[model samples]
Each structure stands twice: as C-alpha cells, then as structure tokens.
Target: MTLTEKLTTEFRQRCEGIATEKRSLLNIRAFEPLPADLLATQLGATILTPKQIPNLNPCVVAVLLDSDQWSAGIINQNPLWIVNNPRHTPARRESNLMHEFGHMLLKHKIVRFDPDTGFPLRRQSDEDEATYLGGCLQIPRRGLLWAVQCQMTQTEIAVHFNASQEMVQFRSNVTGVNI
Candidate 1:
C-alpha cells in the first residue's frame, strides 16, 4: 500500500479511538469543534499564547510570521505547556492547538534546535503524521462523508467544525469528497 494509504488508515483508527473515548458518534454529520482547552486539561496540558510565556522575549513574539509560523509548540513535556501564536484567527488557533495535541498524543520527542538559525528543527515525517492526524481529529472521513450526504457546502462544514475554510478544502481534497 502507498504511504498515504497507510497513514490514512492509521489516522482513522486513532480518530476512532478518540471518538470512542469521548463517547461521540463516529458518523457525525456536522463535526463539532473539539474543545482544545478541555482536551489539554484532560491531557495535563495547558495552552498559552507566546506572549504569555514567562520571560519570553518581546522581539521573538513580534518576529513570528503568522502566515507560516510555528503555530504552536508543546514546551515542557512533563507538564505539557503549549504555546500558540496569538496572531492566528480562532479557527486557525484551534487547528494549531490540535496539531500540538497530535504531537503530544503521538509521544513525539522534543524538537532539536538548529543552532545557526536558533529555531527548532522538525522532522518532516513527524510533521506530516501530526498534520494528518490533526486534520482527522478536526474533520474525520466519516464526518466529511456525512457532510456531503447532507449537502453541506465547504463553508458550512468549516463553520460547523470551527475550522478554517482552507482546512475544509484540504480535507475535501485528501478525502476525495466533493464539497
């Protein structure tokens, strides 16, 4: 099987596990936004803005590029403190927090920093897995299919899931469900 297929299968299983644990319907027509804050609390994590990080440099927060920035980072693995970018919209912030949660759930190790750039170095494979799983958590395949069956538009699905329009489009593309 192709790598994409393998990843999709695994992510689907993970989503199912989460749904079962949460006692949510697996075939939901309109996916309600997973409360990232609640999830963080359950996972012994706390979400905070970059500026809220104690003793964080103001220049560092100012220099973040909201468009392609590292949306969130799970600092302090023991206590699990997540730092999300404040510049993002609410929907985008939710996705960012979900992505961070993905990493935490997958037990990904703390990222190493590139000394030259003074930035955290990411593993492409890990990032891909987290992104895929995060999307699944936000909009599952069953949920997308249900939306299509219900004749929901991309925008409608985004609103229902509290996700960005671009996230909905991406889900449609990946799941091959026409909006």
Candidate 2:
C-alpha cells in the first residue's frame, strides 16, 4: 500500500479506538464534528491560546502568525498543555488542536528546541502521522463517502463537519471521492 493508504488505515483504527474508549460514535454517516475539546479534556490535556500562557512573548503569539503556518504545539509533557493559534479560523483551530491530540495519542516525545531558531523540531514522520490522524479525526473516509453520497458540495461538507475547505479538498484527494 502507499504511505498515505497505510496512514489512512492507521488513522481509522485510532479513530475507532478513540470512539470506543470515549463511548462516542464514530458518526461517519452524519458528518458530525468530532468533539476534539472533549477528547482533550478526557485525556487530561488543557487547551490554551498563546495569550493564555503566562509570560508568553507577544510578538510570537498566535495572533501574529499567518493562517498557513504551524498552528499549535504541545508545550508541556506532564500536565499536557497545548497552545493553539487563535488567529486561525475556528475550523483551523479545531484541526490544530486535534493535531496536538494526535501527538499525545501517538506518544510522541517532547520536541527538542532548536537553539538558534528557538523553535521545536519534530521528526517528519511524526508530523506526517499527526497531520494524517488529525485530518482523519476531522473527516473520516466514510464521512467523506457519505457526504459525497448525499450530494454535498465541498463547502457544505466543510460546514457540516466543521472542517476547512482545504481539509475537505485534501480528504477528497486522499479518499478518491468527488465532492
């Protein structure tokens, strides 16, 4: 199988596990938004905007970043604190938070900061996996198929699932669904 196909399978399995463990339906048919905040709460992780973090640098905060930039990261390992970029749209925020949750679920190690850049560095594999899982959490393949079967447009599916249009398009590409 292709790397994306493998990742897709793994993501689906993880979604099923999360659903079963959390006593929530996968809800692939309804194109429902996955309760990422609820999942974070259940996992004992606190989600916060950059401004909410104590003594954070104002210049580097979420409000200053571009939408296409990195949106969130796990700042603490023990207490599990996540910092999400608030400047992003609500749908992007959800995807960002879900990406951090994906890291937590995958047990990715705390990122090592680059001394020169002062930015955390992560393995490409880990990043790819988390991104894939986050996208899956936002829009499962079954959900995409259901949306297609329902004659939903990309915008309609994005709205229904609380996902960005880019996310909808990405899902369509990955799942080979025309939407």
Candidate 3:
C-alpha cells in the first residue's frame, strides 16, 4: 500500500503534535531548527557508528561501512543505542537519526529480520508512520509555514534547517505549503 493509504489525516496531525511537543520539551520555538543530535542527547540516546558496536563481526562492519543503503536503527532499547551509517552526508545522517527517533517516539516494536533475505521484516504502516513523523521532526508544518512567510527558498530552508533540499520539498508537498 502507498504511504497515503497507510497514514491518515489525523495521524499526520498527531505526528505534527509530537514534533511540537518534542520542540517544546527542548525549549525550541516553532520557527527554530531542531537538530537531531541535540534531540537524541535530550532523549538519552547514544548515537554510534557500526564500528562502535562491540563484538560486531568485522565482515558485517565492513559491509555496513562500505554501503550507503542503510540509514540508522535502534539496536538497543534500554540505553537507546542507535547505530547510524557514517558514510552518509551530514544532512542524511540527521534525517536517518530522526527517522529512527520517530520509531522510538512512536514506541514501534523492533521487527525481526527475515532469515532468508537478512532484511528486517518491516511493517509498511510502521515505516510509513515513521517516515511521516521523521519529516515532521525535521521540518514541522508550522516551521515550513514560517520559512515560507519569511520568503525562504527551498534551498534556503534546507540550509536553515540542516536538511536536504529534497526533504524540504517533500515537506512542502505533504503539508501543502508552497515554498
């Protein structure tokens, strides 16, 4: 199913509310940028590269370090250890961490990987929800509107928010706020 089919209007608004609540907790204004690293710290989460994971197989680490396909994941829940791919751009790293944080905020259960494929058995709705929430966390609808009011271009907004231009455009498209 498509993302639109998985996520409802109320769910989207709830995600926006979650973003606002997180910002409030951090004492960040609606128009201000919320850095994912700062948020992770506030959440008592430790961000780690694959290499930082002790006892990890060297071959697995090599595969992870060499690839850009993977983003990030919460490897541990008690201490909230998130392993992110270091090969990604800074903006991508932020987005990746935010997506993982989205899953955390939503209390999504960790999905087991398929033994045959070695890929996580993700639920489409869960992924959709996390993706929507991640975008909201990166660029809240109110923040987008504020940027638009300030006459910021998509590129400028991306730079201001420390996000990729594509993310800014995606936020605009989803929120129906022309940038």
Candidate 4:
C-alpha cells in the first residue's frame, strides 16, 4: 500500500513525536543518527541470532540461517529478545531492527502462527503502522530536513542514518523534503 493510504497525517505526526521522544531519551539530537544497537541497549532489549535460541530444532535453525527472506522478529516480550537475520547486510539489519522496535513501541500484539499452515497470522493494519513508525524512527522528518539543509546527498544521508538508500528516498518522499 502507498504511504498516504497507510498513514494518516495525525498518525504520522504521532510517529514523529514518538521518534523525537526516543531520541531525547537517548540524548540524541533530532539531526543525529540513532543506531538500532544503541536503542536496543537503552530499551534493555537483547538482540540475538538464530543460533542463540537455545534448544531450537536443527531444521528450523538451518532454515533461518539459510534464508534472507525474513528480517527480524520479537521472540520474547518480557526481556525483549529480538532475533535478526544474520544473512542480511548491515543497513538492512538496522532497518529490520528498527521495524521490530517500532512494533514494540507501538505495543503491537505478537503475531500468532496458524496451526494448519504454520504461517504467521498478521494484522495488515498493525504491519502498516509498524512500517510507518519504523521509517519515522530510522529517519525522522526533522532529521531529514536537517540533512537536506546540510546539502547531504541520498547516499550521504543513508550512510549517516545507517539506512538503505531506498529508506532515505522514502523518508524524503513521505516528508515532502527533497534531498
């Protein structure tokens, strides 16, 4: 779905507020990069790989280790254990982690798996909200504006934010801030 269709103006503003609040809690300026690792640390969230999941089935571990299709997911809520795909690149990993963090921040319910198919039964609206909030957390509107003001290129902004070039472009498009 298009960004506008998924996120309302008020919802977008709320996401911006959340991002700003998170940054403030970390003592990070709006223009500064908020690394996913740092945020996870602050949130007391533990990041793990498939191998770290104790007593996992060998077949499941093999599948997780070999696949690049999955990004990340929240495996535990109380202690906040997130399992990220080690196969993805660093930039993609950051984005994946941010997306997981978005779900946590928004208090999205854990996706339940279908007993018949073993596929996750997800709520599209929740996924959309998490996606939008993830983008906001990765590249806040104010941060995009600051980067633009500094005459940063798309690659520069991506590198600065530890985001993919596509994410930087998406932020620019959603925020109506040309880079």
- lDDT on C-alpha atoms for all candidate structures: 0.74, 0.75, 0.91, 0.92
lDDT by residue (84-134, candidate 4, tens digit) is 999999999988999899999999998888999977888888888888889
All candidates' TM-scores? 0.82, 0.80, 0.96, 0.97
Q: Give per-model CA RMSD.
A: 3.4, 3.4, 1.1, 0.9
Residue lDDT tens for model 3, 102-148: 99999999878899999978987788899999999999999999999
Query: Candidates sorted by lDDT, descending order?
Result: 4, 3, 2, 1
Q: Judge candidate 4 against the unseen true structure and give its global Cα lDDT, from 0 to 1.
A: 0.92
Error of 3 at 32 (Å): 0.8
lDDT value, candidate 3, whole model: 0.91
Off by over 4 Å in 3: none
The ten-residue window of minimal lDDT in model 2 covers 21-30
How many angstroms is residue 16 displaced in model 1 relative to the true structure, after the best TM-score fit? Answer: 4.7
Candidates in descending TM-score order: 4, 3, 1, 2
lDDT per residue for candidate 2 within 60-100, as digits (tens), equals 66444544566888989889999887778898888898788
